[model samples]
Target: MSSSQFQLIKEARLKNNCPECYSNDSLELTIKQKLSETQFYKSITNEIVSDINCLNCELQIFPVRWTDDIEQVVNYHKRGLNLKTKSVALKPISWGIITFFTVIIIATILFATGVLVL
Candidate 1:
C-alpha cells in the first residue's frame, strides 16, 4: 500500500506575549508541508500549514485570536526569518509521461514508413 508523508519546512519561535497567560517569549510558529504518493498515481505535494503555540499558557492561538500588538510582533519576526528557495524538482511520474509520448510518436512514424514490422 502507498503512504503519505509530512515534512517540516519552516519553524521559527516568535517572542510574543501569550493572549491567555500574558507572558512574553512563549510563542512558537511552525510551518509544515505534506507529501502524498500512491501506486500507479502521480505524487502530490506542496501542502503547507502554519500554527502558533504558547508555552506559558499551553494553548494553540489561531490568527483570529491575535490582537494588534501580536500581529505586529508576528510580522516583524516573519520578516527576519527570510528563507531562500530554489527551483522545484519534477516527480518520477512526469518523466514517465514524457517518455511515453516520445515512444508513441516514434512508433507511429516507424510504422507509417514501413520501418517497423508489427
Candidate 2:
C-alpha cells in the first residue's frame, strides 16, 4: 500500500462504517496467528520496499513491490497486516442452489402444461 492508500484505509477505519474496518480486529488476530505458524518475512532485494501507516487506526503497514531498484524500496513488509484466504465451503451450497432452481423450473413447467396434475 502507498501512503495514499494507507491514509484512505485509515480514514475508513476510523469512521468504523466500512465492513473492512469492522473486521480489522478479527483480521489482526488472524494475522498474528498466521505469523506464528510460519516465517512470513522475505527480502529479495533491499530497494523494492514501501512503508505506509494507517491514519485512522495508526496501524503501520509495510507493503512491498518487487522491483529492480533496491535502494528505492523501504521495509514495506513491516507496515501492513498480512492475511490468508480462508477455505470457503461454497461448492456444495452452489450445487444445491442450482439443483433447487432446476427442480423448481421443471416442476413449474410441468404444472403449467397440466402434466403435473396439481
Best by TM-score: 1
Model 1 accuracy (lDDT, Cα):
0.73
The lDDT of each candidate is: 0.73, 0.34
Write the residue-wise lDDT of candidate 1 on 1-118 in tens digits. 5677655666777776788888888888876566665644534455556778998889999999998887887666555553434224566777798899999999999999999988
Candidate 2 stretches with Cα past 4 Å from truth are 1-90
| Runs of candidate 1 exceeding 4 Å displacement | 1-6, 33-48, 82-97
Each prediction's RMSD over C-alphas, in Å, is 3.8, 16.5
What is the per-residue lDDT of model 2 for residues 1-118, given as tens digits with 9 covering 90 to 100? Answer: 1111111111111211212233222212111211111122222212222333444454554324222222122223234534333322334556787899999999999999999995
Which one wins on lDDT?
A: 1
Q: Give the distance in Å from residue 68's predicted Cα in candidate 1 to where it truly belongs.
A: 1.8
What's the lDDT for residue 86 in model 1? Answer: 27
Q: lDDT (0-100) at residue 63 of candidate 1? A: 93
Model 2: ten consecutive residues of lowest lDDT: 1-10
